[model samples]
Target chain A: MMRPTNTWFAEKLGDHGIYTQYMEDHHPAHMPCLEIRLLDWQQAAEIALRLEMRLVAVWATEGGCHDQPDSMFAYMGLAHPEHRHVLLRTQLGRERREIASISRHYIAACRMERHMQDMLGITVSDIPDGRRWIKHEHWPEDALPLRSEFAATTRMAQAEGSYPYVSSNSEAVCQIAVGPVHAGIIEPGHFRFLTVGEMILNMEERLGYVHKGIEKAMCGKTAAAGIRLAARISGDASVGHSWAFAHACEYAAGIRPPRRASYLRGILCERERMANHIGDIGAICNDAAFSFMHAQMQRLREDMARMHKQLFGHRLLMDTLIPGGVSIDLDQRGCRLLSEQTRMLAAEVEHLRTIYADHPSIQQRVIGSGIVSVNEARDIGLLGYVGRASGNYADERIEEAYPPYNELEVHVPQGRHGDVATRVWARFEEIADSARMIIRLLEQLPEGAVSNAWQAPEAGTSGFSAVESWRGEIACWLRFGDHGLIDRFFVRDPSVINWLGLELAVRDVPVPDFPLNNKSFNCSYSGNDL
Target chain B: MLKLLKQIIMTGDKSEPLPDSDAIELLGEQLHAHIRKHFAGSLAIRAVDAGSCNGCELEIHATGNCYYDLERFGCHFVASPRHADMLLVTGPVTRNMATAVKMTFAAMPQPAFVVAVGDCASGCGVFEPDHYAIAGAVNDIIPVHASIRGCPPEPADIIRGILQVIARRAA
Candidate 1:
């Protein structure tokens, strides 16, 4: 019998004919993994559902023989009820490039499964939506870029194929196609809405317009150098993506930086959260034709961004977090500046919140538009403010408790209704919470070194991290190779899950209100497409 | 209404002088003169995001914010390429968005200026110089009149780049 574990993994998975193994090298030291046979792929999903675990991410990497073109492995990341994350793995050979669909069990797995199918040619059998994802007819059908055998520099001529967007057959319903290029200064994605008059009958989003092949670019690069690529994965979530990437790498190498580094990382992440929340609140109001809040809130956000430039050297806090620690240190002057800024921002945000609440015109436009129910939110595996607004109070900071969040009293303010107004309110409350946390972090910051010399982990060592970025919980998986080069890197941005939430939220909403709902959600197109 | 008015008055204006104020003042005067001479001082721009991480887009959006107030320089972002006098493209044009970018440029009127906005648009920033997913820089995909060189250029740099493009057209 395998060693009995303290986690619910042993108790729930013991009878499922699958054995649980602790990832001795996996960072943060809390992830428990189960290696299952390829035949038991769907069975793992069944057990996960029975245990009330949410499917987080799915991807494929080269398996067994690195030189073999036909060998690959599929991995599933699941967040458990016990506050621990679990990874399920299954290796496949040339004979079996297919597995049963887990989307039947977890709706969140739909796009990820299609992504794996498109990127690695791993067929996901029984996947409800078999349409091509992440490849807008850019590459030929035979090209699978994630496989080790495929050269990264091999340029392919753009191929032509039409996306079969789901259409309506009724005369009463008319179809409207939106983008590959939109009117606003935003990222690209196509939205197809089947509507009757102004009421949306159904909505479908076709993304991948911004696929830069980040995973393909990171191949054969050193893990330390990959941070730059990670930061670019989602420009707005730079700190979140890079910090999660660095955390995974450090844990895989089993190198912990000084305690001061953890506190500083917390400060950077909270600042990122606050800045985005403030910006999104303003943008949502702007979408509703209320420009006053947009003007006021943007002024505050710009001030904070300028302060970030003064302290960390990047207006958006990009390139600030690296493996084993942070790139910049906070001095006494920096601390004082941060404290003053946070205090002032807290007061100003409260004033704006009052203005937003008191304005009846703004409330009229926002209140009842684009409401997502709690059940729908849970079904879609929504994270971050999107889920929080819908009553799914699952915050990785408080639940998974990654340090220094483990020490701080992290407040995740939640909303009851998942409408545009509630989502905006959640952002307002989160800004307040983030400001409070930043002030606390400064007061209790430890005195020590900010960065440590990065020691490369041995080849074949893999690490994982789930960080609660401002948008949501961003999950990163990293495997190191010879001389600290990254063998395979996978990052699952929260936008992947939250985009589905957007589709579900806008079901009955009017056509014009789509922008308001979208801005409230503020899902990242580049992040999701990557 | 009273509270809203009170808040607005108390907040006051946070707009600052554009970057390189002296040069911008001259360029602004020239840009307005050129616009008036040509299109009655109405300069419309359309921003296309080919495949950026959105760092550049954020700065571009910031340009429209009250602080930068890009419209004061006689250029405002428009909805369609047909209405545009200039095309401001961000990101290293990706393979997927190439056709769309070309279509947008083709749709614009004659003598449309293209300003490639960041290092990525001018040249692929972090990716390998010639990666598979990338279809070269903005210039390789479309005709670029001026390029702003920064990882993601600040709002001031973006305002300056736009003014210089129009100012050059005027000269």
Candidate 2:
């Protein structure tokens, strides 16, 4: 039984130098989540781990109070779902920029810790692999990217060092390296595979090949422009990432979007989810060599894209999402058209889904291939579809329901098999549910102006906003500076965590099934790299 | 099988068939005829993603669907650059991906027709080429023939641009 409340944990954390000092309760927006300060990072993390608090995101920010100028802040975004979002904060002294690694307790903290090390010059004291995670040779030897001192236009001498991928000299195993440039028209990412014949012994990924310095680039941009940058972080889930950014902007600004605006945002979010899921389902079938299913699903996807173009004026619905609210609005005719299209898609998908479900080839290709066991999924603490497929049953939509979703009944179907087949089936089930959401949203079209005006927040204050993206949970921690320009920005994409799941899933799988397993998860390279 | 045939007939090949007339001396038509005369209308294309947001890739893929059916016009996507006749590159070349893009271009056979698809490849999109992280666009990294400028050109525009690249190569 998974406990949802952290109230008991508060008692367990009793007087650990984490002050009971005043709290900011984000009650109406979310749960009565407390924002607390901690003095001992190591002790607090160990106690929280003992008390069973899931470590969600570890984001580090540079700079402090003007009097205490050399201070660095590290905030761990932890969640218990039913209770609240507990933002645990710890500060590091100026002289010793090193913090003890929490990656020992929680495996998800390694990437974020190394990210802090690479970008902000904050060292994680002792672990194992000390390879450069993000800052490549293109950056100068002593350049700290996220610090206020570093210039935005700093590019060092050309990249000088080659990545030292771990090697195995065993006679039985052989090494194979693929991409940063792949066959498909996809983003760049490197995969190093050690295989015994066709069976993959281990698969390690060296991503961040598409690192665009997105957070670094957001240094001086206004909140509106920062949303645009966020959208580009992951092209496939632009709406999800941008919406999370917008939510953070609104919260930090202390303004509420109207009911109509929230409803519009929900519609946009669900539509985005449906589009990506549909694409994934089609691509999965294609990888399984069932080209007919791919063709059918692709046709349905095209139909939906055309509908988006007609209604929202973009095939991919990239723009039209801004800081305050949606930039575009829909009328009655658009609603009627969307409703009819959803019915058509629902019926068509149902017919095609049966063909896929009963089909022998798809079943043969996917069943028991690239399985992540319940224990592994639990220990790794995967989120979204990857977690649900393994029976982890953490749906942020149900857990942290924001606005219109809080009103509607979001059906989160759980999966058990934890194989490629289970993942594909999960997408189909989720798509069907999203179709109903679309119809409901269109039918109950709330009336009011879509966009709202919001004022900027006071300087030096930060806000954390979370949204359940199609892939999984996406969160953004944002701080406002002078003239409402972005001060410090950090985002935790679902893909960043799920990419680890793929590495673990592919251990015993054959070389050929890699494509299928990869598509089953369909993690975004751009999203993870950023 | 019978139902499938009937469905195909009902769909009735929605593609608007373009004329293969030699009398029409437009650049694309001439290239189409010239390719037909030389390589029997076969054009193998290799697409390079130099850090695009993937909006262009989606439209590029839609061309493979039944509506456009780029394969019908003898335009096929090949896996390796060595086998490709033209390179359709997208996005502003990022500092990390710059080497991969250059290697991909270098691996292509000589007389390769490179079409800088989308405005990003020409260094003028939301992703600027002059940024510290971005090295430059496709042209700044490698030689290009035709610059097809659209944030993400529609499928029709991509098809037309490929034809224009073939014409440029034939010239």
Candidate 3:
């Protein structure tokens, strides 16, 4: 990256006569990799957006500012190329703990803002949807789980009544409600479909059924222990979340892991991305009644999962990431194994790609079904494969220029159709791309110590980090308490934003096609709910 | 089509060794003698996720795929609880899902069995006792016939647990 600069803040905000304070590399070495700045509280979103800066994540923490009655800190992470984030600090306080919502300006701020309000009891005024986002009736009225003062053993109130889902009143439109429990072996999410016969008019989803108080439970736990919680936030994307958490700790403690460790982490991340993508491509085909691809894809996934367990010590690669670097290291045999497997898998995937293109039955099922246009995808700020499929290059590896990535010539696969066919094609292309990257990583395995004994970060300091997961961007924002334990831990699983894509893609498709659409996006309920 | 046929011929015997005949025999005889006499040689299971990490859910799906082939064990996952002979629930019972868990349990016919799979459903796993969202453990919401404990139990472990429930009833 370029040497850190502070002039951009003044260049953008100077016209408003808004006071600006900037810090270079203010966060830890691997943190949300942003320079720090203080913006006028009211214009946080406006100032960042005016500079054409991309919004990464928005999070709030209960920390110092004791004199400002009922005050809590709200941080907005923004990205401006070659680097990743610029944390804009704003306070929500004065006894009310309320702030003007930025949801009207940035659509991504919608769910995250509602999450803050629901979990922290921070009232966000002018929020587009003021209704309970993360809170069901089970949360006791007085229990704001994320606050510093809340007890760990606070009892949940009895959940009561049904959710108030907004519905459109129209002539001859019927409603079909499905799940918190589904027919398939999957996590819980409720989908309400408004249909005129088989064609979908509108679809709305109600999630957070699996909110296990991940943020609340991690509080007071040491950073080492907190990594387990992060890994479990979304089991499928365990490596992504854990690395993000580890990077945040590394950042906060000012520890830069050795180059070898960074390369190993990159391998872990790409392996995760490939496994999910391969399985999803098969699953999307299965949803369209092409069962062979499903079986073959899953078969390939099972092999990958087996390899992960053999080398990394867990089926899902859960807990493979520790604070300073990876907990597991690969030897010569492991490197040879990865090399051979990548060769075999690439050939198999190439064979399937040809079959997918030539087989009319499969092509018919995938090509035109479940389309989410590019404009709609960008408006919500999609990331990773989903964003790439919609012609958006928001991959953090490229945009953030994180170590190892900057040194290597990384090729990001992109597509433009934004339909089931393109999504599947996008995932297939990603798998091939990842195979090439993994092969490269294995051949270039740097020689050094795999990890270091992690030093605890100072108390009262926090860090922000984002890693591109199989689905999209996984952001973790955290702080340490006085005893080197987690003070405030917040995770924004990419599924939290990508869930909206399901709503858009399912519209205009027949009722049966909804499953195909859902599978193509493959938003995880556990990830979003957490 | 020729490639598919050749591959099938080349990759022979994909199935695993069946469990001990004693367990299967006991399972068969037990159903023949006691609970639900008319139902013989087969079982219908409905999987419920009170609140879980979805790690367990993935393993459970693997059990049904060709490698593990759970259906060969005379068990099949059904869509609705009303038609199910047993319930396989995962995750710590979140408050939002507790009522639905109860409703699913109540809907099952008499002599229904509940198999609480994964450490989360059995003992609340890494999650603690009192958190606002989770109620902790599947047993807290419904009576459990068996508990399978793992961060995410292996598919083999899950299949064995389902059989153990029948063996227990037989004894």
Candidate 4:
């Protein structure tokens, strides 16, 4: 049955040279959704705007063997209801490589285009706000990082000095520069805040100081090894990162993980979600100067981490999901232990929610501060808690149910206020839902082999996978080499989408509340730097 | 005052069990002995990232997290040449990141053990090597210790790889 919405999109976009590939009727377990590919960048922007497709992510692909020499290819994943992903591909040659900026159409494309411009040197002409998004002035303009010809030796010989960070000059506005090295142990990134009497007019984030050359190093590894690297992208988001990687690899290989392995993957994924939510809620409260809540929530997070260690033998549950299946299996004892943990966590979270609700200081700090309205949330393409706070309700696990998600019942908590309080509440609600999903999944756990013996796929095929990471939707694209190694890989972390929202949401708010607002969002800096 | 009372009643005291000082010490000693036995002489490692977009840095950092502690194993991320044992790198090494990558390797002490973690580090898992920035695999940079693979390897895998390096050195 062709949904009316998709039919409307097909008609409108088809006239404008956009190709729509329908996969809605097909089983989602085999193929998640239908894919549409646009021939050029202009058509991509036009289709995205006209169709109102949420700009899920934008990534660049530098041609290896298949790409025409002196040319680059870029793809944009635009999503809509009915779980459809429209892929827009544009080709740019060495010299004449300018494409229209989609930022004017979809605000989320601004940072992504800047990222492409920094990495690939492709210019997004008419970008309303293109002031060097990722690249600082430290590197020469000609030195694009993602270019194939760019050698690794040049960085060492290059002189080391501070990159000229552009600052906004307004009377009474002073700049506060924090980090690369903070007072505490946090990831490396620079935050430049333009403030006038504790009122932040504009805040700029300079990340990638910890850029460890992850992409360049991935050139010749095997499939199995590559999955391990994906799991490490964010320690806390291991399952989400690996699931995205494994999904892409499996799609490329045309293999499905056993039902049991998929169920186990769901269990691990929810465990990750629960752990992060517990930690985040506490941290947000702590930021509001509520020490007691922080201590209690930290304790809950620790307990969940212990459960993860007991069940999966690794606290973070990394490397649990391989391409075809899982590395570990939950026996009967493990299943029982997980259920007990889930019940305990659910009870604790409920109690904590009541305590949090009654706290006036937390209420005052969070209720109306850092607001991102529903329209703004949609416009910026926010996801996870940021989107849920504003009532977007787009969780990939629920919207496009994959594996055990299809079987388990998920209760999505939505808020209309779109403030710090709403985000915190949404997280708490997700924790409850995640725990319930785990128990239900464990009950119907399939009986089968945990993982299949690894095998390599034939070269030159590409695939896409999306997983609901703790932050939001994480999408991955993978292509393999002739020698059975990964040829190209792109990971789109939720931080990429949420960071802009952070900038816009925090505007006009007092600077003292910055820490609380920032902690409430808690988007990972390391996740976005790559 | 009322809110405080409610919170106290709502969240019953649930404290995490502290790691037994004795157990941690014993584990530390055993780990040290294992490293000594496996890496009889000196051990040097080089870190390689095949391609990670950077999520793996967290667990890589977690090896140093106050919990699941890595220092007890004598494993550390060294900065410069002449004083390094292992290469603890991440990512697929985009065309842009490649240079700093080689320089870091050149600065490392000899007989280095290269441990590639995460999908991007192992193979260009998610990143296509053909991209304008990414060049090739970790092996393109240096020889490896053990491929403790994942999108990002768990801290345990990292710990396991260091132990393997020790074992290889003993052999």
Candidate maximizing lDDT: 1
Q: Residue by residue across A60-119, what tens digits does model 2's lDDT show?
A: 887533225767877777776565566666667678777778888778888888788888
lDDT by residue (A323-386, candidate 4, tens digit) is 8999998889999988998999899889878878887877888999999999999888889988
Per residue, candidate 1 scores C-alpha lDDT tens digits across A1-530 of 12233356645676877765555544444665556678878988888887778888988888532234556778899886465687877777678788888999999999999999988898899999999998777579988878777788878866778889898788999999988899999998899999999999899999988889898888788867899889889899999999889888887887776789989999999999998988888898898888998998888888888999999999998998888899899999999999999999999999888888898989998998888998888888789999989988778898777788888897777787999888888888888899999999999999989988899887777888899999999999988777779888888999999999898889889999999999988899889887
Residue-level lDDT for A415 in candidate 3: 87
Candidate 1 C-alpha lDDT tens digits along B1-171 = 777789899988877777669878777778778877876788899999999999999999888888888888778999999999999999989887888899999999988999999999998888664777788899998899999988789988998888887877777
Rank candidates by lDDT, best first.
1, 3, 2, 4
Whichever of 2 and 4 has more lDDT, that candidate is 2
Q: List the residue pairs that clash in candidate 3.
A: A28-A251, A29-A251, A32-A464
The global Cα lDDT (0 to 1) of model 2 is 0.77
At residue A510, candidate 4 shows an lDDT of 89
Model 1 TM-score is 0.97
* Shift in Å, residue A129, candidate 4: 3.5
Models 1 onward score TM values of 0.97, 0.93, 0.93, 0.77
Give per-residue lDDT, candidate 3, residue A402: 70
The per-model DockQ list reads 0.81, 0.52, 0.65, 0.10
- Give the distance in Å from residue A361's predicted Cα in candidate 1 to where it truly belongs: 1.0
CA error at residue B24 for candidate 3, angstroms: 9.6
Minimum summed lDDT over a 10-residue window in model 3 chain B is located at B29-38
Q: Model 2, stretches more than 4 Å misplaced?
A: A1-12, A15-17, A20-39, A64-67, B1-12, B16-31, B38-40
Candidate 3 residue A297 Cα shift, in angstroms, is 1.4
The CA lDDT of each predicted structure is: 0.86, 0.77, 0.78, 0.70
Interface RMSD of each: 0.9, 1.9, 1.4, 7.7
